[model samples]
Target: MRIRAAILAALLWVGPAAAQSDPAEAARHAAQLLEQAAEALNGAEGARDRVRALTEIIRAYEAGLAATRDGMRKAAIREAQLTAELRAREKEVSRLLGALQTIETTSPPLLMLHPSGPLGAARAGMMLADVTPALNARAQDLAKDLEDVRTLRQLQQAAADSLAEGLAGVQKARTELSKAIADRTDLPRRFTEDPIRTAILVSSTETLEAFASGLSEIAAGEIAATNADVSALKGQIELPAQGVVLRRAGEADAAGIRREGMILGTRPRAIVTSPTAATIRYRGPLLDLGNVVILEPQPDLLFVFSGLQEVYGEPGQVIPAGSPVGLMPGASPEIGAILSTSGEGTGTDRSETLYIEVREGGRPVNPEKWFRTDKDG
Candidate 1:
């Protein structure tokens, strides 16, 4: 999704001179961003959809943050103007009112009997005519400034109310995103199941490799063959899933335990499509691993997929590039939590962890050297 700036991304309840300059315009812009965020939240569906929604929510919150900070600053400035400069103006107006009162109380006879005589008094009346308009204009100007101050105070209160609601909406959108990732279940399996034998072997294996090895026994007698050239396809294949790779082969886990595999984070039930066409070598549940699917994309080169909740193919089955092979489980830490804890900062927020190993002649090979892009790139 495309991104834009937001003004109401933070709390709005702050000391108010009300809103800042052109508050009405700023408020309208902030309101538009909030509306966009709400629409995104309402239309969100899967992990991708929820992610898009979160982007908008964060943007809106950022906008609110800017708005609130500006509002607070404007309020402070307005208060200072009213207390200092505006207060001085009020005193001047008061003095003008006193002089006008004196002029009105003086009668014509009293003016004619003045020390300077009626001639000077007549000149005073003429001067008064010219000065009255200027005084009246100053009062009007002061009145306009006072009205502006009142309007600013009102704008701030209104902005605060809108921001409060915007903040709540952002939180709600975050919660929904978490829920959508945790509840993913619509996924396709890449390997078939044989419960009678699978159950017996799964219960008997002491380790993950032992269980997958038992399932691999089916391919031991068959001649695995594929026309694709593994060497030619190096660094030209698509990623098995959409995600950010957090660990490479030989990277350590939280306990500092290292493994020979590339660990990446994918959304819940993200499609595990074959990066290239390959014959299924082994597909079944492992001791600690949820489900494992081993594919021979080319002779002596195997693509391993572990930490899946379901498999889609049988032994010797040929799957094409971009074909769905298996599905990942949700973020529940019990059976699937290992995906989260496997890498630092790659926990539940990433949804699921996928362990990918590209082995050549039974030796571990790093996938980073084989794929065009490995992680966030």
Candidate 2:
């Protein structure tokens, strides 16, 4: 779109003033220039070629401007000449009229006077006949001079009309040239002239760059920290617990499993059922997290130690690598005690470890990275 508009601006440039000055010749030159500019711009590929095309367009406008000024000056001069000629014709017409009046005023009487004597009457008649021919001839010459003056005035008017037309064309071309030049340089001029808009564009570019940089930095940091945490957890050792191991424990089954028993921190009460109970806790007198210990060990590992007759931990309290958080109702929290399991597996009953599946960023990543599952024997 930008390229098209630029090309249009180039094409609109005024052509040489010669056409304005000499209407026929100048028009031919203008048509040729227009065609040449259109072809050059349309054919060009690179920036340099476009610049050359624009330069040609500018030249055409400059030529048109110069031509308009010259045409207008010539028109002014011709107008002055025509006015002088018209004035001279007017003077000639006045002079001819004066001569015609003089001839008429000096003429002898129209009717012959009755002579007091015979000789006087004959002489008066002879005098009248002699002046009549000269008077008629003088009148004819004055009429011819008046007609010549009128013709001169008409010719002067025609010259004035032609000059006016030339001037008008020159002015029109001049205006078009000015507008074309303005269009050509408009963008560059706007960027240079208005500080606020330029500053705004620059500032926005810098801000976007900074935001992208910051986000990249944050992602890099998160990756490094998460990697380090996983490495540390891999080196630790985990211990096994003597408790009930539930597999895919549902909510209703958990409630039935709970029983009234006195826990470490609370009085004798019913335990709140937690399905997939991957923890062992003593339900005692403590309010929240009373004896409820969540031992998240590894992926898809669950250990539900219900009927917590005793609880010994609170919320957010980290237990040691091996600690007894609770005591079940039928089972004892002591050494050499075995746990029961109901999973579809080998022997249906084996030692149970509180599986602590530590998750980072929501994915079930390897809990071996945070807890030592290999030591759970």
Candidate 3:
């Protein structure tokens, strides 16, 4: 049908003008070439859309190709299906390129019947100019996916090595084991708050310390139902995070800002546990702190932990000391940049920082005095 349309258009273009010269004939031929070019362009466009979809599918499969202690999940089935789909997509792209070849290698010779001689041939070279970028981009994407496959293999190897280490140290679990406990606790929720509301309520306050002060009023009725004495555990409490103290109490937070809490640079995936048996006052992302949790160990005493990547406990939940509360997602390049600008908490290059504060009787108190471990001091 495309060929017939090209012929018909060329015939109509052959009017009552001089047909003796090559110029008149070339004009008619150009009309025919344009018709065929448009048809090829349309088909190639459809093929390009299909190839884009195929690339997206390949990337999705790559995303799930993580290494694990149990080995890659559904490895056999996913790999086979991805291979088959890639093969089919490659064929479609090849066919689309073949179909577009007609414009360049016309059997009657496109150059012979052209008015501008070599210039006409050069113009025909640009017939598929629009299609080149799409094809080139897809080619680049294929290369990236190839690299992703290699990365996924490396991840698998890493997971296997980690599993072996964990198995060897099964009986000696202590500090390193905290990350899992902090990150993956399955305690029942006493209550939950909307993250959006908690976020908004926190933003309305001046400082993070002030933001925490308001949370003490949450579940105020439950005050009569509990008994936890954090003051009694002073100088004997365990460190919540395992790391060195980066900033001591009364240190500068940013340019001109003063900090009320002590900042500790903890290892990645460091386990975050409650220092004392306490009831949760609030838990969620706050104004500057990436993720913050407020705990009420007793009336008029609030313990604050900030810079967590994930929190497993909910607001109003009561947990004992050394109980898993959350995980400090180790700071990466992305989060490090955010922390530098957000003025939330200082982050180290490789480790994450957690801001620890103790509020007693409506006032911020020194947190370093509570922990007996070398880490907090």
The candidate scoring highest on TM-score is 3
Judge candidate 1 at residue 289 and give its lDDT: 64
Better of 1 and 3 by TM-score: 3
Model 1 regions lying over 4 Å from their true place: 1-216, 331-348, 374-377
- Model 3 is weakest, by summed lDDT over 10 consecutive residues, at 61-70
lDDT of 3 by residue, 1-377 (tens): 44334434433333223223233233234323443433433343234333222222211111111111112222222334455666768876575557546544766564345676777756755654766667667766766655545544454344344334332222123232333334434544445555655666676887766776666444424334555566777887866754567777898867856788888876555557777788888877777788888888888888889899877566867776656567678422332232132332233432678888888788888886776645221
Give the root-mean-square deviation of each candidate in angstroms. 13.4, 43.1, 25.9
Residue 225 lDDT in model 2?
16
Ranking by TM-score: 3, 1, 2
Quote the positional error of residue 327 for candidate 3 in Å: 1.0
lDDT of 2 by residue, 124-192 (tens): 668757866865676576566545445444433443343344334323433333333333321110001
Query: Candidate 1: TM-score?
Result: 0.44
lDDT (Cα atoms) of all candidates against the true structure: 0.60, 0.34, 0.54
Q: Per-residue lDDT of 227-333 in model 1, one digit per residue for the tens? A: 56867778877667656677877878899988878887865645566788787767777656668888878776778889988666556666556545666777322
lDDT of 1 at 325: 64
